[model samples]
Target: GESVGLHLPTLSVQEGDNSIINCAYSNSASDYFIWYKQESGKGPQFIIDIRSNMDKRQGQRVTVLLNKTVKHLSLQIAATQPGDSAVYFCAETQGRAAGNKLTFGGGTRVLVKP
Candidate 1:
Protein backbone atom coordinates (compact mmCIF):
# COMPACT_ATOMS: atom_id res chain seq x y z
CA GLY A 1 0.00 0.00 0.00
CA GLU A 2 1.21 3.47 -0.83
CA SER A 3 0.52 4.94 2.57
CA VAL A 4 2.30 6.32 5.57
CA GLY A 5 3.40 4.04 8.41
CA LEU A 6 5.54 4.08 11.50
CA HIS A 7 8.70 2.07 11.86
CA LEU A 8 7.72 1.19 15.40
CA PRO A 9 4.32 0.73 16.96
CA THR A 10 5.34 1.72 20.46
CA LEU A 11 8.11 3.59 22.21
CA SER A 12 9.09 3.76 25.86
CA VAL A 13 11.05 6.65 27.33
CA GLN A 14 12.11 7.88 30.74
CA GLU A 15 10.21 10.87 32.02
CA GLY A 16 13.14 13.20 31.58
CA ASP A 17 14.67 11.66 28.51
CA ASN A 18 14.23 12.66 24.93
CA SER A 19 12.08 10.55 22.61
CA ILE A 20 12.03 10.10 18.86
CA ILE A 21 9.22 8.70 16.73
CA ASN A 22 9.76 7.77 13.10
CA CYS A 23 7.38 7.52 10.15
CA ALA A 24 7.84 6.38 6.57
CA TYR A 25 5.71 7.39 3.63
CA SER A 26 5.54 6.00 0.14
CA ASN A 27 4.13 9.12 -1.46
CA SER A 28 6.75 11.18 -3.20
CA ALA A 29 4.33 13.96 -4.05
CA SER A 30 3.54 14.83 -0.49
CA ASP A 31 4.75 18.35 0.21
CA TYR A 32 3.47 18.97 3.67
CA PHE A 33 4.04 16.89 6.79
CA ILE A 34 2.44 17.24 10.17
CA TRP A 35 2.85 15.55 13.51
CA TYR A 36 -0.10 15.14 15.83
CA LYS A 37 -0.49 13.99 19.40
CA GLN A 38 -3.64 12.28 20.62
CA GLU A 39 -4.28 11.81 24.28
CA SER A 40 -6.68 9.20 25.63
CA GLY A 41 -10.23 9.88 24.45
CA LYS A 42 -9.14 13.19 22.97
CA GLY A 43 -8.69 14.35 19.43
CA PRO A 44 -5.31 14.68 17.82
CA GLN A 45 -3.56 17.96 18.59
CA PHE A 46 -1.10 19.45 16.16
CA ILE A 47 2.44 19.34 17.42
CA ILE A 48 4.43 20.61 14.47
CA ASP A 49 4.70 20.66 10.71
CA ILE A 50 7.33 20.94 7.98
CA ARG A 51 7.20 21.56 4.29
CA SER A 52 8.91 19.21 1.86
CA ASN A 53 11.31 21.98 0.85
CA MET A 54 12.38 22.35 4.45
CA ASP A 55 14.51 19.74 6.16
CA LYS A 56 13.46 20.52 9.70
CA ARG A 57 11.08 22.50 11.89
CA GLN A 58 10.91 23.12 15.62
CA GLY A 59 8.22 23.85 18.14
CA GLN A 60 8.45 24.70 21.82
CA ARG A 61 9.58 21.27 22.95
CA VAL A 62 9.25 19.35 19.73
CA THR A 63 11.15 19.03 16.48
CA VAL A 64 9.97 17.68 13.12
CA LEU A 65 12.42 16.51 10.49
CA LEU A 66 11.70 15.54 6.92
CA ASN A 67 13.95 13.52 4.64
CA LYS A 68 12.65 13.65 1.11
CA THR A 69 15.40 11.47 -0.26
CA VAL A 70 14.40 8.59 1.99
CA LYS A 71 10.74 9.57 2.36
CA HIS A 72 11.17 9.50 6.11
CA LEU A 73 9.94 11.77 8.86
CA SER A 74 10.70 12.03 12.54
CA LEU A 75 9.45 13.85 15.61
CA GLN A 76 11.59 14.52 18.63
CA ILE A 77 10.18 15.38 22.03
CA ALA A 78 12.44 16.92 24.60
CA ALA A 79 12.26 16.04 28.26
CA THR A 80 9.48 13.53 27.81
CA GLN A 81 6.95 13.96 30.56
CA PRO A 82 4.14 11.72 31.83
CA GLY A 83 1.70 14.16 30.29
CA ASP A 84 3.37 13.60 26.94
CA SER A 85 2.26 9.98 26.84
CA ALA A 86 -0.01 9.60 23.85
CA VAL A 87 -0.44 8.15 20.39
CA TYR A 88 1.51 10.12 17.84
CA PHE A 89 0.68 10.24 14.17
CA CYS A 90 2.38 11.62 11.10
CA ALA A 91 0.24 12.96 8.28
CA GLU A 92 1.10 14.17 4.81
CA THR A 93 -0.61 16.17 2.11
CA GLN A 94 0.33 16.92 -1.44
CA GLY A 95 -0.39 20.59 -1.10
CA ARG A 96 -1.63 23.23 1.31
CA ALA A 97 -4.79 23.87 -0.68
CA ALA A 98 -8.19 23.56 0.97
CA GLY A 99 -9.08 20.30 -0.75
CA ASN A 100 -5.74 18.61 -0.33
CA LYS A 101 -6.36 15.27 1.30
CA LEU A 102 -4.28 14.40 4.30
CA THR A 103 -2.98 10.87 4.70
CA PHE A 104 -2.16 9.67 8.17
CA GLY A 105 0.20 6.99 9.37
CA GLY A 106 -0.87 4.16 11.65
CA GLY A 107 0.48 5.94 14.73
CA THR A 108 2.93 5.14 17.52
CA ARG A 109 2.11 5.04 21.19
CA VAL A 110 4.63 6.73 23.45
CA LEU A 111 4.86 5.54 27.05
CA VAL A 112 6.62 7.81 29.45
CA LYS A 113 8.04 6.11 32.53
CA PRO A 114 8.50 7.96 35.77
Candidate 2:
Protein backbone atom coordinates (compact mmCIF):
# COMPACT_ATOMS: atom_id res chain seq x y z
CA GLY A 1 0.00 0.00 0.00
CA GLU A 2 1.05 3.58 -0.55
CA SER A 3 2.32 5.63 2.36
CA VAL A 4 -0.33 7.92 3.77
CA GLY A 5 1.89 10.87 4.60
CA LEU A 6 5.38 12.38 4.50
CA HIS A 7 8.53 10.79 5.91
CA LEU A 8 9.48 11.37 9.52
CA PRO A 9 12.12 13.80 10.80
CA THR A 10 15.32 12.23 12.16
CA LEU A 11 16.81 12.04 15.65
CA SER A 12 20.20 10.44 16.24
CA VAL A 13 21.59 9.07 19.48
CA GLN A 14 24.25 6.68 20.72
CA GLU A 15 23.70 3.16 21.83
CA GLY A 16 23.22 2.54 25.56
CA ASP A 17 21.94 6.10 25.88
CA ASN A 18 18.46 7.31 26.51
CA SER A 19 16.49 8.64 23.55
CA ILE A 20 13.68 11.15 23.72
CA ILE A 21 11.39 11.59 20.72
CA ASN A 22 8.84 14.38 20.72
CA CYS A 23 5.69 15.13 18.75
CA ALA A 24 3.12 17.93 18.53
CA TYR A 25 -0.38 17.06 17.48
CA SER A 26 -3.08 19.45 16.38
CA ASN A 27 -6.23 17.80 17.64
CA SER A 28 -7.40 18.84 21.04
CA ALA A 29 -10.55 16.77 20.66
CA SER A 30 -8.53 13.64 20.17
CA ASP A 31 -8.89 11.66 23.38
CA TYR A 32 -6.69 8.71 22.61
CA PHE A 33 -3.03 8.87 21.66
CA ILE A 34 -0.50 6.24 20.65
CA TRP A 35 3.17 6.07 19.80
CA TYR A 36 4.55 3.79 17.14
CA LYS A 37 7.89 2.56 15.85
CA GLN A 38 8.50 1.67 12.25
CA GLU A 39 11.61 0.06 10.89
CA SER A 40 12.80 0.35 7.34
CA GLY A 41 10.56 -1.27 4.70
CA LYS A 42 8.03 -2.39 7.29
CA GLY A 43 4.76 -1.32 8.83
CA PRO A 44 4.46 0.58 12.10
CA GLN A 45 4.35 -1.30 15.40
CA PHE A 46 2.74 -0.01 18.57
CA ILE A 47 4.90 1.06 21.48
CA ILE A 48 2.69 2.70 24.09
CA ASP A 49 -0.52 4.68 24.46
CA ILE A 50 -2.25 7.16 26.77
CA ARG A 51 -5.78 8.40 26.93
CA SER A 52 -6.71 12.04 27.50
CA ASN A 53 -7.34 11.20 31.12
CA MET A 54 -3.75 10.18 31.69
CA ASP A 55 -0.53 12.12 31.48
CA LYS A 56 2.04 9.35 31.40
CA ARG A 57 2.26 5.68 30.54
CA GLN A 58 5.10 3.19 30.37
CA GLY A 59 5.98 -0.08 28.70
CA GLN A 60 8.84 -2.52 29.02
CA ARG A 61 11.59 -0.19 27.85
CA VAL A 62 9.62 2.77 26.59
CA THR A 63 7.63 5.58 28.14
CA VAL A 64 4.95 7.81 26.62
CA LEU A 65 4.03 11.23 27.95
CA LEU A 66 1.08 13.28 26.84
CA ASN A 67 0.36 16.94 27.51
CA LYS A 68 -3.13 17.79 26.41
CA THR A 69 -2.62 21.42 27.35
CA VAL A 70 -0.25 22.05 24.48
CA LYS A 71 -1.32 19.11 22.36
CA HIS A 72 2.16 17.66 22.74
CA LEU A 73 3.36 14.12 23.23
CA SER A 74 6.72 12.46 23.77
CA LEU A 75 8.32 9.04 23.87
CA GLN A 76 11.28 8.12 26.02
CA ILE A 77 13.37 5.06 25.32
CA ALA A 78 15.68 3.78 28.00
CA ALA A 79 19.08 2.34 27.07
CA THR A 80 18.85 2.85 23.35
CA GLN A 81 20.11 0.02 21.18
CA PRO A 82 20.51 -0.82 17.50
CA GLY A 83 17.20 -2.62 17.49
CA ASP A 84 15.55 0.46 18.93
CA SER A 85 16.64 2.53 15.97
CA ALA A 86 13.64 3.34 13.82
CA VAL A 87 11.14 6.02 12.81
CA TYR A 88 8.85 7.05 15.64
CA PHE A 89 5.60 8.95 15.47
CA CYS A 90 2.44 9.78 17.33
CA ALA A 91 -1.14 8.83 16.39
CA GLU A 92 -4.38 10.13 17.79
CA THR A 93 -8.05 9.26 17.71
CA GLN A 94 -11.31 10.51 19.08
CA GLY A 95 -15.04 9.61 19.32
CA ARG A 96 -16.11 6.00 19.50
CA ALA A 97 -13.28 3.60 20.18
CA ALA A 98 -14.48 1.09 17.60
CA GLY A 99 -15.14 3.70 14.96
CA ASN A 100 -12.18 5.95 15.63
CA LYS A 101 -9.30 5.84 13.15
CA LEU A 102 -5.74 6.82 13.89
CA THR A 103 -4.27 10.03 12.48
CA PHE A 104 -0.48 9.88 12.42
CA GLY A 105 1.95 12.76 12.79
CA GLY A 106 4.77 13.30 10.29
CA GLY A 107 7.22 11.18 12.31
CA THR A 108 10.79 11.26 13.60
CA ARG A 109 13.62 8.90 12.74
CA VAL A 110 15.83 7.82 15.61
CA LEU A 111 19.31 6.64 14.66
CA VAL A 112 21.17 4.76 17.35
CA LYS A 113 24.90 4.72 16.83
CA PRO A 114 26.83 1.73 18.02
Candidate 3:
Protein backbone atom coordinates (compact mmCIF):
# COMPACT_ATOMS: atom_id res chain seq x y z
CA GLY A 1 0.00 0.00 0.00
CA GLU A 2 1.07 3.58 -0.60
CA SER A 3 0.88 6.48 1.83
CA VAL A 4 -1.01 9.70 1.18
CA GLY A 5 -0.59 13.33 2.15
CA LEU A 6 2.47 13.84 4.33
CA HIS A 7 2.21 17.63 4.08
CA LEU A 8 0.51 20.38 2.15
CA PRO A 9 1.75 23.22 -0.06
CA THR A 10 -0.07 26.45 -0.90
CA LEU A 11 -0.54 28.51 -4.05
CA SER A 12 -2.12 31.93 -4.32
CA VAL A 13 -3.27 33.71 -7.45
CA GLN A 14 -5.38 36.67 -8.50
CA GLU A 15 -8.64 36.18 -10.31
CA GLY A 16 -8.21 35.74 -14.08
CA ASP A 17 -4.57 34.80 -13.55
CA ASN A 18 -3.02 31.43 -14.14
CA SER A 19 -2.26 29.02 -11.31
CA ILE A 20 0.35 26.34 -11.22
CA ILE A 21 0.37 23.51 -8.69
CA ASN A 22 3.25 21.10 -8.29
CA CYS A 23 3.57 17.59 -6.87
CA ALA A 24 6.23 14.91 -6.42
CA TYR A 25 5.19 11.31 -6.72
CA SER A 26 6.88 8.47 -4.88
CA ASN A 27 6.85 5.63 -7.38
CA SER A 28 8.64 5.53 -10.67
CA ALA A 29 6.49 2.58 -11.61
CA SER A 30 3.38 4.68 -11.49
CA ASP A 31 2.06 4.90 -15.03
CA TYR A 32 -1.02 7.03 -14.59
CA PHE A 33 -1.44 10.40 -12.95
CA ILE A 34 -4.50 12.46 -12.20
CA TRP A 35 -5.13 15.91 -10.82
CA TYR A 36 -8.04 16.49 -8.49
CA LYS A 37 -9.67 19.47 -6.84
CA GLN A 38 -11.35 19.22 -3.47
CA GLU A 39 -13.41 21.86 -1.81
CA SER A 40 -13.99 21.97 1.93
CA GLY A 41 -15.83 18.88 3.16
CA LYS A 42 -16.13 17.35 -0.29
CA GLY A 43 -14.31 14.55 -2.05
CA PRO A 44 -11.79 15.24 -4.75
CA GLN A 45 -13.10 16.09 -8.19
CA PHE A 46 -11.09 14.98 -11.19
CA ILE A 47 -9.51 17.76 -13.21
CA ILE A 48 -7.05 16.23 -15.65
CA ASP A 49 -4.70 13.30 -16.20
CA ILE A 50 -1.59 12.19 -18.05
CA ARG A 51 -0.14 8.80 -18.71
CA SER A 52 3.53 7.98 -18.19
CA ASN A 53 3.90 7.59 -21.94
CA MET A 54 2.74 11.15 -22.42
CA ASP A 55 4.42 14.23 -21.03
CA LYS A 56 1.37 16.46 -21.14
CA ARG A 57 -2.42 16.40 -21.25
CA GLN A 58 -4.97 19.16 -21.29
CA GLY A 59 -8.62 19.57 -20.40
CA GLN A 60 -11.05 22.42 -20.66
CA ARG A 61 -9.08 24.88 -18.60
CA VAL A 62 -6.50 22.61 -17.01
CA THR A 63 -3.24 21.06 -18.05
CA VAL A 64 -1.24 18.26 -16.46
CA LEU A 65 2.44 17.77 -16.97
CA LEU A 66 4.57 14.82 -15.91
CA ASN A 67 8.31 14.64 -15.51
CA LYS A 68 9.21 11.05 -14.88
CA THR A 69 12.90 11.88 -14.79
CA VAL A 70 12.32 13.72 -11.54
CA LYS A 71 9.16 11.82 -10.65
CA HIS A 72 7.44 15.16 -10.54
CA LEU A 73 4.08 16.39 -11.82
CA SER A 74 2.47 19.77 -12.23
CA LEU A 75 -0.99 21.16 -12.92
CA GLN A 76 -1.71 24.43 -14.64
CA ILE A 77 -5.00 26.27 -14.54
CA ALA A 78 -5.73 28.98 -17.05
CA ALA A 79 -7.68 32.02 -16.08
CA THR A 80 -7.95 31.09 -12.45
CA GLN A 81 -11.19 32.15 -10.84
CA PRO A 82 -12.63 32.29 -7.34
CA GLY A 83 -14.40 29.03 -8.16
CA ASP A 84 -11.02 27.45 -8.75
CA SER A 85 -9.95 28.00 -5.17
CA ALA A 86 -9.57 24.58 -3.62
CA VAL A 87 -7.14 21.96 -2.45
CA TYR A 88 -5.51 20.32 -5.46
CA PHE A 89 -3.83 16.93 -5.39
CA CYS A 90 -2.01 14.60 -7.71
CA ALA A 91 -2.80 10.87 -7.63
CA GLU A 92 -0.75 8.10 -9.17
CA THR A 93 -1.52 4.48 -9.96
CA GLN A 94 0.31 1.61 -11.53
CA GLY A 95 -0.72 -1.76 -12.94
CA ARG A 96 -2.37 -4.63 -11.05
CA ALA A 97 0.89 -5.66 -9.47
CA ALA A 98 0.31 -2.77 -7.16
CA GLY A 99 -3.39 -3.55 -7.27
CA ASN A 100 -3.71 -0.52 -9.51
CA LYS A 101 -4.19 1.38 -6.32
CA LEU A 102 -4.29 5.14 -6.35
CA THR A 103 -1.92 7.10 -4.15
CA PHE A 104 -2.43 10.80 -3.60
CA GLY A 105 0.22 13.39 -2.89
CA GLY A 106 0.02 15.77 0.03
CA GLY A 107 -1.78 18.36 -2.08
CA THR A 108 -1.53 22.12 -2.65
CA ARG A 109 -4.17 24.61 -1.69
CA VAL A 110 -4.92 27.23 -4.34
CA LEU A 111 -6.36 30.55 -3.29
CA VAL A 112 -7.85 32.89 -5.88
CA LYS A 113 -8.11 36.46 -4.76
CA PRO A 114 -10.53 38.94 -6.22
Top-scoring candidate (lDDT)? 1
- Candidate 1 — which residues are off by over 4 angstroms? 1-8
What ordering of candidates by TM-score runs from best to worst?
A: 1, 2, 3
Q: What's the true lDDT of residue 46 in model 3?
A: 85
For model 1, residues 1-114, the per-residue Cα lDDT tens digits are: 222224547898999999999999879999999999987777889899999989999889899999999999999999999999888999999977886788999899898999
Candidate 3 segments exceeding 4 Å error: 1-7, 96-99
Each model's TM-score, in the order given?
0.90, 0.90, 0.88
Q: Deviation in angstroms for 51 in model 2?
A: 0.4
> Could you tally the backbone clashes for each prediction?
0, 0, 0
lDDT per residue for candidate 2 within 7-102, as digits (tens), equals 557788989999999989998899999898887778999889899999999899889999889999999999999999778879999965585789
lDDT of the structure predicted as candidate 1 = 0.89
Better of 1 and 3 by lDDT: 1
Roughly what TM-score does model 3 have, to 2 decimal places?
0.88
RMSD of each: 5.0, 2.6, 4.7
Reference-based lDDT, residue 104, model 3: 90
List runs of model 2 lying over 4 Å from the truth. 1-7
Which model, 1 or 2, shows the larger lDDT? 1
| C-alpha RMSD between model 3 and the true structure | 4.7
